[model samples]
Target: MSINWDLYNKRLNLHGSTQRDRLTKEFKIAKESKASSNPSCKTVKVNGIDKQVFIVAKSDKTKFSISPVNSSDTLQMGDKIFWKNADWLITELSLDDDVYVSGTIQQCNYTLPFQLNTSDIIQEPCIISDNQTTVGQDQNKIITVPDTLKHILIQYNSNTVQLQKGKRIFIDKQVENPSVYEVTKIDRITHMVGEHGLLELTCEEGQVTEKDRSDLLIADYVSVLPTPPVSDLCEITYSGFPEIKVGTSKTFTAVFKDESGNVLTDVMPIWNVIVPNGYESYVSFSEDGMKLIVTVASEFDLIGQTITIKLSNVDNPDGITLDVKVVSLF
Candidate 1:
């Protein structure tokens, strides 16, 4: 082949010009194409404050981005993106290439399984690992835990509004001793996603039973008390009274209940002790009005005295009365 340096140089220049023209045309076409359409702008309340953001999305996964029209509001991580029938948490953001946004899909129709340990009085930390496999399945299903999950975050739909952080909720897995869980944290900001926000719960260690597995799959979610207690119902109860010695002390616990006999888990009964006329110096009540302490002096007049310690509350007139006998061995 004959070597033509001048012709080779000219051909190289022409090819470079053609490639530049094609690149420019492709860029113009990409810029003209809409990333997403029919964008919806909404204001979500975060921390009792309103934040406005626009969501631009389509049914196709590739055709989704946040705030395509308006640049004022930007989508950040932890912001929930509701596209189609599924809920997705924004995990990545890209402003280049006509704005590419993507996130992992959180099943809207499924509730995360939480196991609780009820063997002890204090609840154990919630076990949310994805190691357990279901029946007929060789591999375990993956579950996503929020980055801010120091506690259990239960995402509730429409039927879980009554669930609050301080209220106790029932969890039944058909065990002999069913355990109740307390709501620990409630994410008020991301609550604007679907039906309601997410709830943080105190969970113990356990596995989901096969019987309740259907309920979890069907999105029954978790049932909570429709009406939670707000105030005290003014009912007090305690164990039987014991013999009062000269120098011994006894501790008692009073349980408060409501009109429907439901234990007042949030209320503390106000107690007032009315000791016998002469026995006032021997018997006294605690400062918080919950415990009754007794101390008999050596100079007490009667060793065998039948004293009536009236445990009453002015606010709640329906109180109990116990007769404690004071005995001293000389």
Candidate 2:
């Protein structure tokens, strides 16, 4: 018996449209193709004569789709389709018919906020999910990272320590302690995203006991996207040295910021005073650390001798060290 794969794909596309049409709830897909670096998915009109790949719920409460797209690219594994307030990551695909392609997708339960810790901290929109070989058997979770993280995954597999630590992953929650996972296995698989790859890591849950499962309260991708703060101190802008009279006090302030000159908020500065010999007690910091007050004693009258007011931003440990030279106005 011959299979009518094209007809099967057409039916799948129609079913998704009837239940939830693409027009109202458009399925947005962003991937690089030969034409565009990040091309958005554009299917033929559902009423038109071309393939209109759409998502439909199956009998088992699972979602399925058939992307009979107008482009040369057929739907492949790992292609993310955002529909119905969820990220449906394509995990399986079958292209029996050249005109239409069908695939199976699963819900991305979590978003791994992958940070590329370079000069500028870049946050990768990495959507991921987890599975255990035996449900509730052990604390091991198979972390499935979609193909969008190909470059970051490559850095992860590097033999060099510096390169290996180029990227980091975190999942934070509103609770006291966020769930942590330690990587047990690291591997990759070929996936299509206009030609992207994937990362699959066997992560053992750090919070082993059932009572310590804070991941349950963890914020979703949308919730954590804006909240998780990443601040890298590019430079510190401080007030110029004020002329200090003998036995008087003067206050100075500094602002920490990133490469874009956007002031890094909620960050504190580590103030250090390098005075000549007996001038240690002269300098004192404000309660909130916003101001540094230096009371120059009358005996300290050396104009050339400088009090190195060095401050470091805690966000980036190798933070900027600035000097504040105090000149006495006799």
Candidate 3:
């Protein structure tokens, strides 16, 4: 047997009133409860702005209250609410589990700035994620111009529903010499309960006018490359091995070679090492992800223990392993 909950909605309208102006209004709140399942919305003052809050508790399946606002406000994606005086950001919205809502606790109410090209041709608002410039390491010479890549986020607007990949957008608010960008990636957010959607876009930073400030442009353009074929019977080659003595330091550059002697640089091999007790710092990888450094302390008690190393590739799960001796005196 199903239960029916009769809910009541009270709307208060104040007119020229003091704190103790009780029961002197021409309009009184309706005092009858009605059975309804349709979601309702109301605007509340939050941070000096009127924010729409939703209530969907009539059809709640959880039996218990998942959100404190469920009794008064309908739940929606990206809804902001306060609990115990702390602000919470609504990350997910669902009604399957009794009108569930989930999100992270925001330390404070914050607003993001918009960087958009405000022209009559395109008036939709968009924001840049971050901007960055490359260090001269790739060029190996004196760089004249800085290379940049921009990560852009464009919110889904009900007015313009035709936005897709490869669409060009403006970066600045100026129409005189607008900075344009071609969208590359579109990250879509979907929910099983609500119809709200958010789009995360990636763009290649385009030409900017010399008159504009350089600091306005941000993001790094990383080239997406194809992966190489998986290798069989891969071999792990490194330097300075056979016996790692205590109190000594050695560096090893490990590279995986295929059956045809071709180095598999695209296939990232997982490194797995096992060291005995007290020699935990015997092996480590370099910051550049190319070389491995091994430093064993002389005070290690387990002298004859074996150190095993395994390098694995995704396509070839059965990886190769190498064994080394742990020596105390040389």
CA lDDT scores, all candidates in order: 0.44, 0.48, 0.48
Q: How do all models score by TM-score?
A: 0.32, 0.37, 0.29
lDDT of 2 by residue, 1-330 (tens): 999999977976762545445332233222122213323243432212234454455665655554544334465555555554555566667756433466766655554443223223332223454452332423476554332222222212222122222122344544566655545555554443334334555454444344222444322122223322333444444345535555666676656766555776677777666777866666544534666776676555445566666666665555445455556565
Off by over 4 Å in 2: 1-52, 69-73, 118-168, 190-197, 207-330
Model 1's number of clashes is 4
- Candidate 3 per-residue lDDT over residues 1-330, each given as its tens digit: 654433211223243243333242221111112212324443443333554443344343321122332324344543444433444334444545322242222222322222233312333333355555545554577444544456644435443345556555446543455466667777665421235434556677566544334343321222234344443446655565566776765555557676567776776766677886666764443424655565666656746777777667677776767786768874
Better of 1 and 3 by lDDT: 3
Indicate the TM-score of model 2: 0.37
> Which ranges in model 3 have alpha carbons more than 4 Å from their true place?
1-72, 78-127, 131-147, 173-178, 189-194, 208-330
Residue 330 C-alpha lDDT in model 3 = 47
Best by TM-score: 2
